[model samples]
Target: MIQNSKLFIAAAATLVAAVVLNPTPEQHRARIKEAIAERSPLAGFLGVGALTAFASTYHPLGLASYTTVNDHTVSIGVLGMVFVLQPSKDT
Candidate 1:
């Protein structure tokens, strides 16, 4: 429990850093794809195309995004905190 929470917090911090540094979805995807490539070549190759497909709306200090490759997940970030969710396939 505590260990899992720590890992989750670390992941969230890393994700926030990535988002902050890579403000655009394309840049963020590329960074993630590179990381994936480092671990698995095949998935990285496949990621090239899927990761390219994303729609985003950004505000002066925040962003809202929809990514197909992430199981149709929608993500929103404000004040450095990010939230993500996958809607039902039926929708």
Candidate 2:
């Protein structure tokens, strides 16, 4: 329960920060393109497929806060693993 609360808080903070920063549309598109461009062809295909499957799971929940919190944890876990595996550019 505590961990889930922490994840929710962190996500809230991130959303607040984004709103405060108000990134330009071009900046947002550039960032999105950079992210998509980094993925291999096979990985990108599977990622889109998996995301579609995940979206299909949302019908029952219908945009509940708890469901969002659960999804955030999955994203946080994936990002945690990626950060752990990747070395810092300054190294």
In terms of lDDT, the best-performing candidate is 1
User: Model 2 reaches what TM-score against the true structure?
Assistant: 0.26
Residues 1-91, model 1: lDDT tens digits: 9999999999998768655653455544444445545556886677742353333333333333433443443444344434443336687
Off by over 4 Å in 1: 1-22, 45-91
lDDT measured at residue 54 in model 1 versus the true structure, 0 to 100: 32
Q: Which stretches of candidate 2 lie over 4 Å from their true place?
A: 24-91
What RMSD value applies to candidate 2? Answer: 12.9
Superposition TM-score, candidate 1 onto the true structure: 0.31
Each prediction's Cα RMSD? Answer: 10.0, 12.9
- With a 3 Å backbone cut-off (N, CA, C), the pairs that clash in candidate 2 are none
